[model samples]
Every structure is written in C-alpha cells, then in structure tokens.
Target: MRPWTLIVVSALVLAGCTTTTSGLMARSNDTEVKVNNRNLGRDLSLSGLNRAMVGGRLQARAELTSKASGDLYLQYRFVFFDATGKALESATDGWQQLNLAGGERRQISALALTGEAVEFEVAVRRIVDE
Candidate 1:
C-alpha cells in the first residue's frame, strides 16, 4: 500500500474509536456536572453544586447565576444513581423550571425519594421560547 494510503486508513480507524459509547462509564466523585447553556445567554453559568445526606437521603443543591441584561429561563433536573452506577427510578425526579433575572443568583435543591441513592448529577439546560 502507498504510504499516504496507509496513513489515511490508520487515521480513519482511530477516528472510529472516538465514537460515543452506549454502555455505562465509570464516573469519579470529583467529576464535574456538565450543563448545556447553548440556548441561553452567554452570561449565565452554573456556579456550584453540592451533595450531602440529609435525613438519611441524598440531597443536592445547585447555584445558578445570570449576568445578562434580562431574565433567563431554564430547566434543571437531578438524576440519582446507586452505588452500582444505576439510575434510581423516581417519578418525582422531573425537569423543573427556573427563572433568573440579570445579575441574580439562585440556589435550587432536590431530595432523593429513597435512601438507595448514593450519588447524584445535576443537569441544566436553557428553555427555548417558542
């Protein structure tokens, strides 16, 4: 095979390995939660997130701040996971709405419905207006 052809083939093979995996991946306790702010203003950001055991159940709190010149609408949810990395089934864990004015900061919190939750992840996304 030509040298250039061999290099191109190897590059294609390596690129295929970068595809997303469907299986569960191990996550560390120090992993930072990712928030999708694409549709929101650039001045909005997630400041902090903290998780703790409250009343024998998992409790999560997230702080959001908006430095924009207007109000920002968004949605957030808490996904609880057990020690084995399985997500806990709970009907109450649904997307909740949030509104933040310019230069405003707000803290949102959620409690696990059961004691089986050992870890939690918070996801935030901008609410697109129709």
Candidate 2:
C-alpha cells in the first residue's frame, strides 16, 4: 500500500503509526512543542501526514536538543487505528538513552508497528536520568 508519514512532537516519545526515512523529511520548523503546565514545554499535534495514519511501518523524525550533555534518555509511545478513524490500541516504550552534544540536532528513529499496523500514533519524552 502507498505509505504516509506524520511528525510527532516529544519531550517524551509515544506509540502509533508514522514513518520517518532518516534524510527523507527535513527539519519541521512549522511546529513547536511546549508543555503548557510549567516551564517545561513539549507540544503534540498532527503534521506532514496525508489523511493521518491507520496502520503500517510508522516512524517519527524528531529534532531534539539536550539541556545537558553526558547520557540522556528518550521515551516513545505509539497508537494504532482502524480504517474508520477509530483508536485501536496504544503502546508506550521505555526510555532509550542517547548522548547529545548539549546543543545539537538529533534525529530519533523507531520501527513502529509491523504486519497489521494499518495506522499509528507516536510520543516522545525527555528523560532527566542522573
């Protein structure tokens, strides 16, 4: 089937259907993530996907900047959907550590759901692991 891709905003990563081919889509300056609760900000919305994702090999292309160097972790989650735009199931992966250059753009990748993955959703959370 013809594939579609969506961009997910993360200070913490979540699950669902979306595709990201490394160098395929460039930096998306159109959207921004900010936590409305406090000084911490990370936004989540739909971007760069045609008609949303139902199921397939979904991936998220995120550009993140670490507040500090050393070792950092990224949390990701995914949501699945049916053909009629209904939420099927949601899955959240644990924190994956990633080393950053303090002020650098890092692209995080995921395999998403396979086989019967018609459409999907995603999330990302920055870990403050010491």
Find the candidate with the highest TM-score and give its number. Answer: 1
lDDT (Cα, tens digit) per residue for candidate 1, span 1-130 = 6999999999999987884322112222655534333435366766567778888998877777786988877777777889998998654577788888989999978888889998776666667668
After superposing candidate 2, which stretches have Cα over 4 Å from the reference? Answer: 1-38, 42-56, 67-74, 78-92, 115-120
Model 2: lDDT to the true structure: 0.41
What's the true lDDT of residue 119 in model 1? 78
lDDT (Cα atoms) of all candidates against the true structure: 0.70, 0.41
Question: Could you give candidate 2's per-residue lDDT for residues 94-130 as a string of tens digits?
Answer: 4355545544556554444543435544444455447
Q: Once model 2 is optimally superposed onto the true structure by TM-score, how far is the C-alpha of residue 26 displaced, in angstroms?
A: 17
Error of 1 at 112 (Å): 0.5
TM for candidate 2 is 0.40
